[model samples]
Structures are given as C-alpha cells and as structure tokens.
Target: MKLYYMPGACSLSPHIVLRELGLPFELERVDTKSGKTERGADFRALNPKGYVPVLQLDDGRTLTEGPAIVQYLADLAPEARLAPPNGSFERAQLQAWLNYVTSELHKSVGSLFNPSMPAEWRQATQQAIGARFDYLSSRLAGGGFLTGPRFTVADAYLFVVLSWTSHVGLDLARWPALKAFVDRVAARPAVQAALRAEGLA
Candidate 1:
C-alpha cells in the first residue's frame, strides 16, 4: 500500500493509524500545492479530488476522506480496539462522533487556514467552531478522552484538529480538557513516531 500524504495535515490521522496498526505500507509524499507526488507524477491523475491522505491499497483500491480511511484501517485491526465492533451500538456511537469530527471540526479548520475566504464567512466559521469546541470541552470535562475512558478514533481526529490551534491562533488555554487531551495524545509513541517521520517532532 502507498499512502499519499502531507505531514502535519489531517492526513496525520491515517498516518498515525497505519503506524498503530503496524501495517506494512509505504509513504508517498504529496506536494499539495503542486498537485504532484514525490515521483513527479500529477496527483490529479491519481485522485481527481487532488487531496492528501489518499491511501492506495495493495489490492489496487484508493481510499480518501479522513474518517472513512481511519475506520477502515481500524476495522483491519479490531483487536487494537481503536474502534468498537462493527455492528454494535458502541460502533455506531463512535461513528457518530467520528462524523462530528469530520464534518464539523475538521472542515471548519480549513476556513481558518484559507486567507482567500471571505471575512464574514471566516468569522462565522470561527464562531461555529468555537461553539463546537465548547461542546467538546464540556463533554471532555469528565476527563479520559473524547468518548470517555479509552482513546478511540474520535480522540485521534480531535488531536489532529486541536494541534492546529497553533496555526489558527485558536486559544487552547480556554479549554482545559482539550489542552490536556492534546498533551496526552502527543505523548503517545505512535503519535511521536508520526511527528518524527514528518520532521515536526
């Protein structure tokens, strides 16, 4: 499998997942701005969407989207317990949280990074993200992680978003649980490995 990614992007989620699963996969660095892979091939030809985190499976299938790819990889190692059993209520619950992280928090963070976005739209996006952060803050007030207790894929997504606080100027000091959560996830060996591989550790 060849995973196309840009380090420290949302692609980091799948990078971390693959590392955690101990999967035998090679990394294909994507220069997102150039729309080209490291080998000088046009990324657009590989993925029309022209995005990172496109996992070219060994079976010759490519998977995109952060949540979908993470869930698929987690299922590959169910005993890793990154996800609950596929058919269980717990699994649905995890999926629900995963969807929230993907649609709500993940995409909203994009607006902050794009200066080309309209000011009003960016402000509105920031406000919406702020509300969601508050919601997560309260939910995490009880401690542990996003879904409470063990670290699930939801925590992984949240970690990716929260780490962007430095880039977006989002104040982490306001959310105690969130700040603590970032620290905890950063300390994980797999996460550190991902960071080191990206040269950001």
Candidate 2:
C-alpha cells in the first residue's frame, strides 16, 4: 500500500496508525496546492477532491478522506486495537467522536486558516471551537483515550485537529486536560515516528 501525504497534514493520522499496526507501506509526498505528487503525477487523478491523505491499495484501488482511511487501516489490524470491534457500542461511540472532530472541530480550525475569511465568521468559529474544546476537556478529564483506556482512531483524528491550535493562534493552555492530552498523545512512539517522518518533529 502507498499513502500520498503532505507533511504535517491530516494524513499524519493514518500514517501514525500504519506504524501502530506495524504495516509495511510506502509514502509519496503530494503538493496539494499544485495537485501534483512528488513524481509529478496529477493528484486530482488519484483523488478528485485534490487533497492529501490518499491511500492506494495493493490492488490499485484508492481511498480518500482522513477519517475513512484511518478506520480502514485500523480494521486491517484489529489485534492492534486501534479501534473498537465493528458494530459494537464502543465502535459507534468512536464514530461519534470522529464525526465531532471532523465536522465540529476540524472544519472550524481549518476555516481560520483562510486569510480572507470574514471577521464575523472567524470570530464565531473561534468561539464555537473554544466551546468544543471545553467539552473535550471535560470528556478527557477521566480519560485514558477518547473511547476508553485504549487509544483509538478517534484519538488520532482529534490529535491531528488539536495540533492545528498553534497554527491558528489558539492557546491550548486554557484547557489543562486538553493540553495534557496533547502531551500524552505526542509521547506515543507511533505518533513520534510519524512526526519525524513528516519532518514535523
């Protein structure tokens, strides 16, 4: 399998999962801005959305979207317990958290990066995101991970989203639980390896 990624992007979530599962895979860098891979292949041909985190399977089929890719990869190695068993309540809860991070947190943080975003929208998003952070802080207060004692794909996705706080000038220190959660996730060897591989360490 091969993963097309831009350094420090959402792709880092699946990249970390791959390492956690000890899966042997290849990595190809993508220039999302130009819609080209390092080899000069058109990224839009692989993923019409024109983004990073595109995974090509051995059979030549492809997968896009960070949440889907990470879940698929996690299922590949269930013994790793990167996600809960399929169809279980824990699994559903994991999906719930994933959806929250993707829709509620990820999109809001991403919008702040747009220089031309309207002031009203930016302020609203920041306020909304802050509330979400507060919610997560409470959820994490008793946590080992998002779903339970074990780390899951949801944590991986959330970690990537939270990592964007610095880029948007949001100080995580306001929420001690979240600040500690970031420290905890960053301490994982798989995450560290992914960070170093992406030149983000």
Question: TM-score for every candidate vs. truth?
Answer: 0.95, 0.97
lDDT string for model 1 (58-137, tens) is 88788998889899999998889899988999989998998998888888986699878888888888888889989998
Model 1 residue 59 CA deviation in Å? 2.2
lDDT by residue for model 2 (1-201), tens: 999998878898899899889999999999988888999998999999998899999999999999999999999999999988899998888899989988998888988889999888889889999999999999999758888788888898889889989998799999989988889999999999999999999
Show model 1 residue runs off by greater than 4 Å.
none
Q: Clashes in model 2: which pairs?
A: none
Model 2 local distance difference test score: 0.91
- Candidate 2, residue 71: how far the Cα is off, in Å: 1.1
Kindly state the number of residue pairs that clash in model 2.
0
lDDT of 1: 0.87
Model 2 quality (TM-score): 0.97
Compared with the true structure, all predictions reach lDDT values of 0.87, 0.91
Number of backbone-clashing residue pairs for each candidate, in the order shown = 0, 0
Cα lDDT, model 2, residue 67: 90
